[model samples]
Target: MKHRRLEVFLEFLFFGLVMGITEDLIALKFATGEPLTWKIILIVFLVALPFAIIGELIVDRVRWWRKIRRTFQKHVSSVKSSRK
Candidate 1:
């Protein structure tokens, strides 16, 4: 369990880093009419950071939702009497 947790942590870290760099590059290209270095950093922080955070939160919620669904289904079945 601990090993799996560490692997998930590393995976999310790499994902966030890649997302940040990719967003910075896209922002740089879009800002061709203006300065790049500053725009890249600003966009990475302003756009990518929030996006990653929200994405992670959404994924976490989905996992929780699945768990709750399974539990609710189990409870519903248990409360019903089936002729088996």
Candidate 2:
């Protein structure tokens, strides 16, 4: 469970890094008044906004969700062994 949480966290970190660089490119192209790249970057960055929020929400919930999953797994394992 802890491992799963860590994995999720790492995924979010990677996503954030990618988005950050994309956003930077958007800013750079916009500042330079490049038409094609600017429009593409702008659209992508705008689309990424909702995903960023969802990522943050997932990151926030991972800890609690992991704990709950671990507890449930442990309980099930104990019950099975006891029955055997």
Candidate 3:
């Protein structure tokens, strides 16, 4: 169980590292016209590392999203009922 969690985390970390570098490099190229540098790569890595974990958490955890959707649905139903 523990090993599975670690494996998933590492997977996301690797995914984030690759995705972040690609997206950041493209953005930097078009947005700033700045040349790629070690500093920029390091910065992208730093930003993406935490986001990878966060993305995993957000995607993995659907309970909160379901709750929010239910609440919204209830609210819309109530509004419709009131109108009718």
Candidate 4:
């Protein structure tokens, strides 16, 4: 269980870091045409820190996802039954 959590954490962290750097680079470049520097890269990492935490805590929760899926399925089945 703990190993699963660690795997998810590392996965999210890597994705967040990659996406953060790419997004910030494009936005900053187009918005200001500023050159990429070590400072900017560091800032991007800082901004993505919270995203990593959120992914680990909220996105990785299987129980919450399952609840959401169940609710959606119920709603869909009800709609189908009404149409029949």
Query: lDDT for each of the candidates?
Result: 0.71, 0.74, 0.84, 0.85
Runs in model 2 with CA error above 4 Å? 1-36, 60-62, 71-79
By descending TM-score, how would the candidates be arranged?
Answer: 3, 4, 1, 2
Q: What is the TM-score of each candidate against the true structure?
A: 0.46, 0.42, 0.71, 0.64
Off by over 4 Å in 4: 69-84
Worst-scoring 10-residue span by lDDT in model 4: 48-57
In model 4, what is the error at residue 54, expressed in angstroms? 0.9
For candidate 4, write residues 1-84 as lDDT tens digits.
999978867887788778877887899899998898999988887887787778767887888899999999999999999999
lDDT of 2: 0.74
Highest lDDT model number: 4
Residue 51 of candidate 1: its Cα lDDT?
62
Model 2 lDDT at residue 84 = 97
Residues 55-78 of candidate 3: C-alpha lDDT, one tens digit per residue: 777765678789889999999999
**Model 1 Cα lDDT, one tens digit per residue, 1-84:** 999976776678569867786867776677775555775576667767666666566655568789889999988888785633
Where does candidate 1 stray beyond 4 Å?
A: 60-62, 65-84
Clashes of each: 0, 0, 0, 0
Please say which candidate is ahead in lDDT: 1 or 4: 4
